[model samples]
Target chain A: MSDLRSGSNLEKVLKAGHFAFTGECGPPKGANLEHLKEKFMPLKDIVDAVNITDNQTAVVRMSSWAASTILIQNGLEPNFQMVCRDRNRLAIQSDILGVYAMGVRNMLCLSGDHQSFGNHPQAKNVYDIDSMQLIALVKKMRDEGKFMNDEEIDGPPRLFIGAASNPFADPFEFRVYRLAMKIAAGADFIQTQCIYNMKKFREFMKMAVDMGLHEKCHILAGVTPMKSVGMAQYMAKSVPGMDVPEALIQRLRDAGKGKVAEEGIKFAIEQIEEFKEMEGVAGVHLMAIEWEHRVPEIAERAGMLPRPKI
Target chain B: MIVANPKPISEILDMIKDLKKILILGCKGCVTVCNVGGAKEVGILASTLKIARIKGGNPVDITERTLERQCDPEYIAQVKDIVHDFDGVISMACGVGPQFLSEAYPKQRFFPAVDTTFFGGAVQHGIWAERCAGCGTCIIHYFDGMCPIARCSKSLMNGPCGGSAGGKCEISKDVDCIWDMIVRKKMEQGRLDDLVRFKPSKDWRTARDGGPRRSIREELVI
Candidate 1:
């Protein structure tokens, strides 16, 4: 069972022809399980895996380690997130080892947001190690058998390390370079920032293939549905670097106010289809954000059903 | 605050490749105030250097120690024992610290890891710009409070230059033209004629080109 669990999830996702689904499990602001368990109950069978975000947006969400353990104990595969925003070398090193001891193996390492972007703007940020260094730190523990503090773990966690990329926002040339750095730092898989344009997505994939990353690591396409016409406009305008094309905006506008949700779902399904057909796209990560219940329907419309076996 | 462009980290690390033992020395004086050689910056630079060494297959034994001021005689004396143990020392201080450290410990090689940026005053929190060039002359009375000599792109003596486009310097679109700001301030105060008044030519005898600059007070010396 341990060996099976340790295998690359990307392999399983790719072997399954239908689009693979993933969703976020935002940790509540508090520690109580009452709100969390109720939320996990609905996401269990719908998603291939649910990621427990670590202080997402740096607003002090529930501990990702605890949330992942709870979800894992309840029979849901939880992808634990670990950010380098608030922790130094000692904390980061210990947390990676400590979470592994709890039997939660899959991990996503992130640089996290600068505190200015969060609700608590005055909070100090500890970018002690950036995202690339975080990835390298984990790889050092797993591959070189040493932690950041130069301490040897009894047995390193056989974690399926993942990193994030923002092809949509970062410079086109530098985006590929950054992903290459992440891969070199031992990212077994990658989940990109929210994607809106299929053409740009395809170009990004092509660049990955050019860098020989397609064969080395799995690439997961990120898709988020527009909740309303107002939300779509806000995302395009307010969100830095997320360029939702004018045509898609028109489509949403023409669909009228009442059918916006339905139109958004259809657009998401189109993205899932496009992602599945693209060469070297290992899987798709569907981020419902606050709208978790609509994921099952979105998955069904994308013709993606859970295929448990390879 | 002596200005010098320190070598990049990768280059410095490569220069000390042959050394098995490395000491990272940080100055908590000017470098600390400037946010370069502080405790946080020292830790980060040390970690990067260690990682670079380990990954590069050298795997050095690196030690990090920070002193109050690396340029002073007493501070340099305090690190003498620590300096004898290391094959090389990477100083995270401004330009003066490395030379001082080298002069104190001639046996140990020294390298600087931070580029001493400038001699300036704090404009805001974590923001500093070049104000005084350490020239022996004080010319503040001529240009109100603003230092047109240092802040202006052209360093024009009389008034605003034509290179000011939309309040930004023509040389670089990102930076603001200091001369334009000065003109606006003068006009707002109804002293625009002051901009055209004759100003004595700057005395170069007190500048760096003159010789080694020095300052002393007779009462303080006694």
Candidate 2:
């Protein structure tokens, strides 16, 4: 409706009516440019855009803003992620302008993992604003060309704003309303938390469709292929709000030791196929966490290769 | 009430170990109600310090005193006559006590015996949890009297942020996901639409972000 908010590659692909596919790559713990490039290079031509995680899992890493700039230099479009865990409104607004000046056009705002889960448990958290407010703030800066205080901005960042949704979290019925709230707050797209419970996700999507949320913004279902039985078990038991079903774990275990990774990819491909046809799913966010090298293979097998050259 | 926990005995001992004569001052305020700082605790701490000093062969003179409220200037003035007799003082009140004492008696050294934790009430016999951040703005009426500012790990005004599961926070199982409770309460009351409304970014200028806070009541002022 607004002629491409940021004119980003991901926005172009989605607007072109193609089943969009995106990948994720976390920055290295330190400034290892070669390693960072190698980690995300596999996704360069295979996915619509690469999401550079912002200190994902609350573990310290190179700043996402710097990493996103590096990706842009390496001939890749970066979906720069900014978390509300570490920065106040002052720093948040400043970094937004800085990254935008550095050529970042896409941003994913998140209420990051709490500090207690990270290396610095004693660190003070600065959730000066939540993800909902961050979405509205970004929208205001782009649309109204104003800061949070209503001050005029010299050059507002035209970011294609994205917000994360978790359909599997508790108080099940409220999750859809929360998604509506995010959409109302000016989220251009939604990338959900990794989905393992298909039944639950389908129900959540039905509600969203009923509310006609999909017509308002792009919805990309999140999928992370399980690397091992232990990984599946860990996500099922340890990760909060993750809805890894017991049957999915059994499928990984049944894959047997040497074949689980391939089976995991197979499952992911199947999910992608279903998402392509799903009513409200506009795309699939393939988060090949620590498995970036296999993204090309997953994309090819999922029939998402030859990414649209919009 | 202001909740606090006692500092380690070893740390308390290290604080007064260098002093020849010290006073262990307690407050009959929130610290007394919480049982960390009171007449009984002051006496016990004094005896423990004397025994520890005697065992270490540094036998020192000690005095124990309990004020009605160490935060008030009138109560703090009660110690003006004899406060200088001691080389230092160990205040068993909340963090405010030692600072007030130091402010009232600038020439004397005052050490805090307990680490002030949060503004909360005892949920049970011996357990307490944070209930308010004292953000200088109160919005608990919007969430069934629950304060997400103090309870939610991220202080998300619109929340249950993806990490909430089974009514518990992602930080720990012991912590309740206040957002979950808030949503459930709203749902039960058929007021879920209230939560559906978007809450804008909180103006934190009213909170500690504005710097050290001060409150005034002109009607009560003489």
Candidate 3:
């Protein structure tokens, strides 16, 4: 038994200096457990851990903790994500304890997308705590065995905490500093927003390295293989905080109609190749959202297959 | 100042539909400044309601009155003499006006004609923007005089959340991301360090989350 924070596979893989590969799976809108299991089955041994999103994009879905429990039952480690959009502090802390008890060892703290972007546009949001405060709350729960109110818990949730960073978001200079803040708040690992602008990402990573944030936390570069030119264009124009460079869109366009997806995968593979050597990049969080079936192939091509047994 | 918008004539008409006589009361305070429930608006509303009722084949007798400020007891007392003369009173002030009127004259039905929205000021001749949430504690000085509690969509203390882009909020292109403004202002002043410090979880007790709040200045009391 080696000394480790959470001792989860994701933590062990990163700790042992293996270029980690993680995947994301958004829970279904309805409780279709078999369908949900099928979506993540390909990633069981292909990646170190699978991130289960909590009402991703604020659209209602199966709860991340419940989905995480399902993954655990299926013999996979889950990076259970909790967003501050739906749950207040009371609900958040309670869910944290409940999920940990269900054998969840990894968690990702996020300030979820605003409710207006979700299926229920009129739904009231609960941001009783921001992502930064949430990070601190989880760390206190794990490290001190205490809740936000400083009450001692009989059993603490010793989990590997993760946070999300979007390097493409505006006031661009502040992005790195925000990453540092999350790390300071006690995030052990980070999975950034999906990257398309490698130049900007490199600059952002450079700043993180300069500030020594990479030394404190494992920074996982986010990768999402574009499936079509429309997907690339939509991400570029519609998605906030997404920097889908024109060059990547054109490359997808140039790869005639039938081959755009292959071009997209090629681009993602190229990115994975570069990220393997990029300073401050400890892993790649491949979010082939709704495109999970192709993840195994992408992982194999990126040379991340046969994940470390540690 | 408090900003409000007049409830639609259809809604106001529906409220007073059963009454033949009604008082269209206006406030000469925040509602007046926002051009919603001023003395002039009271007269217009009275005439409009009369036309709407007459066209609907049920004529209504409307008596227009504008108080100095319906939120104050003194102004509320002005309507006492004629309070019983009308079937109902339509307070064309903010939501507070109708409540105060109802409390002052429990027997008479006071209907709010305007929906009180927020503490804001007119940005232009016809535009109003929210500026304060009245969160009880004022921390704008920390962020170079901008309030995220009122402006940011999520009211995040340590934001611009991931949704901030090109100075606009994710909710709408028209709404400015207040955190963006705060961050840029701090950067321009070479005070970027001001925002680097973590803003801990807000004590929402200061705000309405603690429940309906009250303030009593000891010196002014009694």
Scoring only the A-chain of each prediction against the true A-chain gives TM-scores of 0.93, 0.99, 0.99
Tens digit of lDDT per residue, candidate 3, span A121-182?
99988899999999999999999999899999889998999999999888899989889999
| Model 3 lDDT tens row, B114-148 | 88899999999999999999999898988888999
TM-scores, each model vs. reference = 0.60, 0.99, 0.98
Residue B144: error of model 3 in Å?
0.9
The positional error of residue A49 in candidate 2, measured at the CA in angstroms, is 0.8
Clashing pairs in 3: none
lDDT string, candidate 2, B70-128, tens digits = 88999999999999999999999998899899999999999999999999999999998
Ten-residue region with minimum lDDT total, candidate 2 chain A: A1-10
What DockQ does candidate 2 score? Answer: 0.89
Cα lDDT tens digits, model 1, A86-188, are: 8867798888888888877678888665455567877765545556677777878987788766778788877778888877653344456567767867787
Candidate 1 displacement at residue B196 in angstroms? 53
Query: What is the docking quality class of candidate 1?
Result: incorrect
Which structure among the candidates has the greatest DockQ? 2
Q: How are the candidates ranked when ordered by lDDT, highest leading?
A: 2, 3, 1
Q: In model 3, which regions exceed 4 Å deviation?
A: none
True contacts kept of each: 0.00, 0.82, 0.78
In model 3 chain B, the worst 10-residue window by lDDT is: B187-196
Error of model 1, residue B89, in angstroms: 41
